[model samples]
Target: MSLRGKRLFSVNCTLGLACLTLCCSVSPLFGQESSTSSSGRWLAPDALVTIAPAMEPGETFQGPVDLPLVLNNPDIAWDPHYAPKSDTLAEMGRDVVFRGEVYCLEFSFKPVRMIAVDIPSFTGVQRKNVWYLLYRVRYLGGDLRPQVEPDAFGNQVFATPQSVAAETISTPKRFFPVFRLQVKGIDREYPDEILPAAKRAIAARERVGQPLYDTVEIMKQSLPVTTAAGGHSLWGVATWVDVDPRTDFFAVLVQGLTNAQQLKMQGEQIEYLQKTLVLHFSRPGDTMDEMQDRIRYGIPALEDPQRQQYILDQFGVEKRLDHLWTYR
Candidate 1:
């Protein structure tokens, strides 16, 4: 769609976020007017995509939304041979499509990072220093199941209202997730490592008689992720939800909240959400000359071995990347 005459909707925002219409233009909406990089060039085949937020908008609790309130009693560690097995770099030079009534977002950066991994509590290969692009997810035409219910911990089950269990969810179907967990690259199905855990949990639930009646499938969903890729639109990337092997992430959220903050977030009106964007760039060290050199000469400046060493030597990787946060 041509964003020709549409004056961008502006609103109160902070950090890298700037408010824009929900169906915002794909143009670089929040960056400087300069069209080219310091080297005077634009990213090639740069794919602009929308990823559902980790949680809904609002500033009540910590983070986009606390993950612990969303996942399990126990978290699962990602497979050690996780990354390097796939391309975990910032996504660029690819095509992404999202169908059904959707919300569009654009960023003025190359290799836009898409991540959804919550460590210690939940795990599935993740990279260092990525910003989760928060967008609203919606399924076009299908049964919208309510993915929430009290868990063993007595807190909410999922982050967003109508979320789905990716492990058990069928593909070629559509869904907007609470948030899509960011990983290094396309995922491969691993063994059902959680079967033992689930069986034990189910037996315990049976003893309690409640049997975790509604969440059995979700628990079983701790199975492997499907390796399917390179297909039609929504099915490609927007199809799956992260598998919660033990719900460790969710457990943490429940324990971390102060009683007051917890009640208010689940019930009251908190800080306003103004459709904002969060920018997470690579560790600095790219001088204007370095950036210019790559753009002007078509050399892979950011990927150059020397620059890679410079970044590792400088910051050593984002221990706590503050740029991804809005408040906490």
Candidate 2:
């Protein structure tokens, strides 16, 4: 890869970590359908993210509030606003972790005083196929009721299920097979990437005299103020199943302008492209054994030579992954 490609990859890697990195706890992000209860989950659990309101803003921030992330899904507009709390994570989001997919996240947001909506129901739910889960979480929200309830933590456990499922890809006929190569179960440490990634993503674009608009910047600001006391992250690699199995999957940069800012490029220029958001959280350069698990960077190591070599050079690759993390 070229120099710019390397820099971009680093930024992508760091930001991916920032997006889903949360405090330590049980795999609240893990749950599956069994021979049990009520309805279907409108939103796939695999793609859910939880954020707590920042009661007190941090040093670099001013009144950061919690709001559902809005992606450009012509199918779904806004997600049901989800207010998260440290205790309620158990109920907020959990995935029926197949194979070894894992996620963690935290936000330095003060609780916003907004009207409360009752959490949606998945009382008795069934798991959707892989493709369905990918599409809904990747590009849609805001139709069905949310999956939520108060867990023992006194925190409201919830899932943002839309009131009505958008017809966009409602049926399988409308769905086309998306190529995916997911290689899970690997871990490593690259404390060096944090600061540089934040600065690089910020310098790329400054908004209103502030660069917080960038994802990495958002992470930089959020990490300190937010804490998942018992959180951990995972790392692994794979090219999309159909894509170059040799070349591993990489990061998601908004390409042109961030996808949300695409409104200005409407008409012929409006290309509603989709970028996957992977979240992982970990502290940089910390050596506390109390911290057993750590944030797993979502960047999957591809079997391709370029990708494996790039990761090896950029972040120290773990020995366990050395088997696939080899040259082409």
Strongest candidate by TM-score: 1
* Sequence-dependent TM-score of model 1: 0.19
Q: Which is the leading candidate under lDDT?
A: 1
Can you tell me which runs of candidate 1 are displaced by over 4 Å?
A: 1-52, 56-160, 163-291, 295-310, 313-328
Tens digit of lDDT per residue, candidate 2, span 1-328?
9999999999999987776564222133322211111222233442333332111111111112221221222333324446544324332222211111111122111111111112223674322111001111111211223355788888885543324332332321111112222222222111111223323322232111222222222222321111123221111111111111121222211111111111122332323233222222111223233123232334344688775566554334442131121110
Give the alpha carbon lDDT tens digit for every residue of 189-277 in model 1: 22112232333433342232112212223322221212132111211111122332221111000010111112113432234223233
Quick one: how many clashes does candidate 1 have? 22
TM-score for every candidate vs. truth? Answer: 0.19, 0.17
Local distance difference test scores for all models:
0.26, 0.25
How many residue pairs collide in each prediction? 22, 49
**Once superposed on the true structure, which residue ranges of model 2 sit more than 4 Å away at CA?**
1-162, 165-263, 266-268, 279-295, 298-328
Residue 64 lDDT in candidate 1 = 36
lDDT of 2 at 299: 36
